[model samples]
Target: MSFRAPHDGELLKSEYALRGFLPKADPLTAFPCGSPYAPLDEIGRDLPSLLYDKGFRSYARGLRLPPWQTRVSVETLPLLRLYYVRIGFLASAYVNQVGEEPVETLPGNIAAPLIDVAQRLRRPPILSYDGYALYNWKRFRKDGPIALGNIDTIQNFVHMYDERWFILVHVEIESIAAEILAAIANVKRKLAQDANADLNRELWRIEGAVRRQVETLKRIPEHMDPKLYYKTFRPYIRFFDGVAYEGADTAPMQFRGETGAQSSIMPMLVAFMKIAHRRSILTDHLDDMRAYMPAEHRTLIKEVAALPDIGAPAYREVFNAILDAMASFRRVHYGWAEDYINRRTDDPRGTGGTPYMRWLQQLLTETEARRL
Candidate 1:
């Protein structure tokens, strides 16, 4: 609930904390039909009901969707993301929604804008964590805190509280990441100045931030029933396997779903905490998740990761605590994935389109192994 971005301006990635990786502006609720891309926002608003209607695909085809001019710029980046995320939801729902067959080709009206907006952002034209959590929420009050209690998801695949709670929980956790990022930034500054004594304290702060994230992550079951999550809403966010954009590209274009792996927070922590995982399929997939993150967030991980090791014998214990905290976080994630996804289906693949059961266990095991 508290905004923990560094008090000092020099401390963290500005994009990570500024108005919460969530857009500072309230996203437009509707675009006029005059806009070439009105369906993204307009039909997107009514998507839940339309999804259930057997005629949904035909209805989408009925709309007149124009190709994007691609006149996007960094200044209106949030707007483009707004358009991108909405269209992404539409495409996912059209393909994965219950009544429809899992269609292999994404419609051009949807594909065109999705690809155009995504090209501008330099990320895959799919619903990623940036679209799913970071750009998917709005606050109840104009001046309220950007926390779970005050915010709600802007677009949803279904009209369920479980869906709302599921997304907002990530929003709250992303807010908590500010504290962790501040700690990482201070550690970087201390490392640069050869201040080993002060580094331990900052490392402890990082451990504390990881603990806070675990607490929020643990609250997933309180409002969101795992059954509803798995059966109803989860399908819309799964990997785009063998699916091609109707007009954008004819080849089968695949991208990971809007999973937590795409979140910049944990990757930044992984790089900053120095918890080295042995190379494996899971590590490669983790590395691949970076491509789904915002470009600056990707750069931030690189910047933190490029720092030389702490190298001080005294800081090893604190660093070990940080590793243990990270392992604990992964353990909680692994447990829920088992309870929620693994038990429900035969498919070993998670939303990230990886063998998640093995992958998560591997992650937890690797982090524990790095302990001093």
Candidate 2:
């Protein structure tokens, strides 16, 4: 299937449905008023540059709450709202100032509402130890002297939040997807193992469809330049910053965190491939193994258990296929990197900042070598 934009509401609903957690789809009569929660734009605006670069906006998109669960998410919404606010405030404060300051003191008054909202929502407040703060803050502070003056504060904020938030969001979404996929797969396995062959066929069909959707998601585009967006709002789009002193032959390059909701899908892709492979191998020989299998079969089961974690040969082939699919999907959907390289004169300094550039380069190089 061609890549198309995902409906966030629908995605969330599917997620909840798959998990058997269908939430009430009641209309939110009125959104809570005068709450400490900040507007989405405000949170976006206030995010640190480094964090922004890593693709917090993309991460939010990946959050795609099901429409039916919006009311249910109300409990977590305030917390979600506050979490971004704290990120925004910290981004604004730290960006405007050049030095490292305590997270508690950085935002001063603005932080009050954020803290209050977090408490009310039971969401943890953004802190120095959180992945966002730990990875990028020190580097941002160290590089304070040379960043672009107009966007220094924003850059630092985006970078700091990008890595920490990307990891957190990626892990959560992938974990949820993996659980649902595994459950569906398990049901199919049990049905196949049973004497009721008709029921097994029905379950297998449902499992197949779910598997296709999961594969479709792996091909979805998650990375894009924010500048290409139609809206006036521009959050951090670049995943890195390049600094070239007047006489230096090569610019210093720093990796910012990923951007966009789809970027978080990578871990899910990896997990799904692992699960799918194990399921395939297990179900393929399950009937045979049940009757005359030796004690060595126990070792095989143990080996399969370790595949997803340690990436055994079977899992490796499955993962490679998935990666190949992703690469082909990207090239077909977004055009090859040769176009980009030609346009940018193969300048790493400029293209390196783009999240998609690295992947594009890799794909193009592989394609070229094969032709040669």
Candidate 3:
């Protein structure tokens, strides 16, 4: 029962002070995208209950392993719930964004100001500490059955802390989605031009559809102050296993939990691209991610993939751009790793043990080799 003592707690406070952890509004006030089953804000209400009920029910009916295993599964439900909130919010946001405009209408000239403002928004590096995940939030509740029993509890649980990290992650999601949509639009435009037409009706339709989605990102709440998030909330968001580990003491620590790697939008985009191309390498990883998405968003993505003339000659170039995006994302996060993990821990494990990091490198390498 020995914890890391005053050092970890003191360090957390100091770091929070140093980083300027001030949130202007509640992070839950930040929107979730639209869902058919629920409103945009409450889109993922049923997830926790669904997962818990299904998981134990399935275990009961089928693979009855060990009692401890079942307990482990129950214990892990909160983590799954938290993950769903983070990612489901993104999917819901995207869905709501798509709903802002009808696909039948042409994507009008998006104002320069909108694009400029979004472009100017700073993208922060992914920070990792061993403590954020360590605190079992479920235990913090009074009537704690170690499960997110209802939507109200789920709502309260997520907003219990400053969720600036999730907000930042949402920013990345929108930015990356916008980039991909732009690339798709460019491809569509080129295809239209090649067909000896003044205006490609299909291209306009595609542009309108993608543009609506991209513009929705612009509506993501601006409540998160970057300085505040990094300084205050980020430090406390650790990966300590609660009882056994209390997390690090000093500034800049290695990332805890696989979520630091898994929940990243770039990796998910890369996964989607691979799946579209029928690449089986990361199917399991993608499947795990799929659980985080709203059902409609998944259907929307499928429709995007099936768009006519998407796999044209321009597909290679667009695909290469996507690969580049994934590489660039890795580079940024790697820089954080270098500063936090490598420099602090003195372990040169950048892109070494992390499967997602290695996957990005391998994918890039294979892509370049194919070009050669």
Instruction: Kindly list the per-residue Cα lDDT of model 3 for residues 281-323, writing each as its tens digit.
Output: 4434444443333232344344334434332344455444444
lDDT of 1 by residue, 1-372 (tens): 111121323335564444434454655555556876665676777888788788888887676665565466766566677787787788788778775568888888778878877878899888888888888888888688777789888898898989989899898888777777776676665555553335667778778878888898899999989888998899999889888898764688888998998887777777765677889888899899989998877777777677656635667788788888888889999999988899999988998899998888887887788776
Off by over 4 Å in 3: 1-176, 182-283, 308-322, 342-356, 367-372
- State the TM-score for model 1: 0.90
Question: Who wins the lDDT comparison?
Answer: 1
Write one digit per residue (lDDT tens) for candidate 2, span 243-284.
221222334423332232122232233333333322332233
Give model 3's clash tally.
12
Best by TM-score: 1
TM-score of each: 0.90, 0.35, 0.35
lDDT of candidate 2?
0.32
**lDDT of the structure predicted as candidate 3:** 0.31
The lDDT of each candidate is: 0.77, 0.32, 0.31
User: Candidate 3: TM-score?
Assistant: 0.35
